[model samples]
Target: MKRLLAVLATATLLVQLGTTSASAAKPVRSSAIQWMGHSWWPRSVGGAPGPSGLWSPANATVDAEGRVHLRITRDRKGRLVQGELDTMDNGWGYGTYRWEVASDLTAMHPEVVLGLFTYGADPAYGHREIDIEASGWGRTPITWDYTTWANGHNPVSRTPVVPGRSTHQFEWAPDRITWTSWDATGALLATRTVAGADVPVPYDESIGMNLWVCGCTSEWRKTPATEVVIDRFSFTPAG
Candidate 1:
């Protein structure tokens, strides 16, 4: 009888241990985002029905048929550059975002790009910024040039995503920004702060993706048909 009782006690202890572990596991969360539009970029000029970056008018709307296009070029020495113009103006713009990188990716070189024309002229908004480039080989590191001004200066924050395979969530709020990355079993790899900056003035100017071809030399090393696609994008207002 004592032996049987001992066996029952061991089983009970195991059950309790399991229960504790289950409770210890962290929870994962995703953002509440709504899709505004869906568009695809073509690898070639003639492959799809789209407007070339050269033809982007004063105000343009990206359609569902993969028609919106940006002109990409290689310099004399072969480098990637944004075409001739900065298409973002009054009506053309981008919304703010909260994002999370998937944890399952062993390596990711995530980047956020904003389009502004400043080729021969002064920097856009009279300032420049480059922050947070992580975990990619041979890719451009996160970098930007910033110009300071009076009253309220520009400030920015970069959020680092953990390295592992898991689904993560990102939320951008005025008071605080939240991020969570979890594994297949829903174990949190890392949850932390996202880098941000405060605008000195009211920047009502629009933002979009723009680049000049000759200004960049990195294209020589990259292959053709190398197009960067922003798979998902959205915005959430501060509360």
Candidate 2:
């Protein structure tokens, strides 16, 4: 966790609190990274993607298959560059957010990380963040970490990411938040829920996706590239 825990440059995070991740990012290949019917803005915080290295909008692009690709690469300067995107909509609260991953996460570099989550910039409700992240964090057998933060405490659920298409989701309401995972065949991989005051209330939070070199240069020195593909993101308000 540390500074990267819930800290996502609140000043910048707030800018992405534009609209819900509905049908807006349209998939446009070879140019702008428009995909899945929503608008996603590629961003760089302090010239880097949080916790280290540089960021390039080029690393975030849409494929001909209509998938969102988040990647990490070594630039001509030998600088490790990562990628992240913020949804261009706000007004989202208390809803079910789902992301379908098309990559084989288990094959990714141990130090490389991919995250899909909702976040805000204020201190309330721990930056109003909830995350579904896949990374080994220098460990083997890449795992997916599901987390909900409140104040400074974060409740997490870690589970192995299966091969093939996988869907990660969280349903947030006024009283509770439910997290679930399903494999390509719709087999339940894991599920967990948190209720009461700890479950963060929805504010001006929006969706985001990122791929970064987690262990920094020490680990990335060996492999300067990695990537993950997000098939699409969908949201349904908790009515």
Candidate 3:
């Protein structure tokens, strides 16, 4: 009787150990909006069918390492699905928003757009926006564009996309907004600044990050399914 009891106890211990090991090996996936204090787009709001794509909570997740992964793919109906996370409230006056791109933006399909921007369009407050968009079209060269839009003035600057892991940032001030791209080693790849009248004035808007397909461009619609991984995102209030 004692020998049988000992054998059963040993078997139970082994099972427990195996369960622990398996749990440790699996990455934990959590909601990106809840973890990062952002909101999923196009769910309750009505808008045009293409730019925002179809946002799915299942498409946005935070891995075990706390990195946010935004995936873009197609559903069974051949509809393009994407991921988007936006802040809950306006960023107020001036501040800096920074995030890291874990995927190779330069290698993405031309139709794919990784956007970091401030969005607001209200007639009472006037429209205001600032954007840093990275896009590629099939085998063509990838490009990054920094754009600022207001009621009357909208300016854009284009540059070659930087490949590999990199940090991208946008610093918004009262006078100017600066968009910068840097590699993993902290070496700056490109910088674009919009100043004077082109800068977006004070308005109520939330910062957002999205991985979506551009439907307006006919060639962009040809891109295959892809993903965009984000290592981190932070906001620093301006002094």
Would you give me the overall lDDT of model 3? 0.62
125 Cα displacement, candidate 1 (Å): 7.4
Task: Give me candidate 1's TM-score against the actual structure.
Answer: 0.34
What order do candidates take by TM-score, descending?
A: 2, 3, 1
Q: Where is model 3 more than 4 Å wrong at Cα?
A: 1-32, 36-46, 49-53, 123-126, 137-139, 151-155, 216-221
Which has the greatest TM-score? 2
Task: Please provide, for model 2 over 1-239, each residue's C-alpha lDDT reduced to its tens digit, 9 standing for 90 to 100.
Answer: 31343324553443443323332222211123466777667755433334455777888888787888898888887777888887766657988999998888878887787888877665678768788888877777888888777645564688988889899999988888889999999999999888876688777676788888676446555655888888888988778
Which regions of candidate 1 fall more than 4 Å away from where they truly are? 1-95, 98-199, 210-223
Q: Which 10 consecutive residues of model 3 have the lowest summed lDDT?
A: 1-10
Best by the lDDT measure: 2
Give candidate 2's TM-score.
0.84
| Candidate 3 per-residue C-alpha lDDT over 70-185 given as tens digits, one digit per residue, 9 for 90 to 100 | 77777788767776665545535588888888888776877777887766533222346677778753335777777776535353666777768888788988888888888878
Q: lDDT for every model?
A: 0.27, 0.73, 0.62
- Segments of candidate 2 deviating more than 4 angstroms: 1-33, 47-50, 216-220
TM-score of each: 0.34, 0.84, 0.75
lDDT of residue 142 for candidate 3: 74
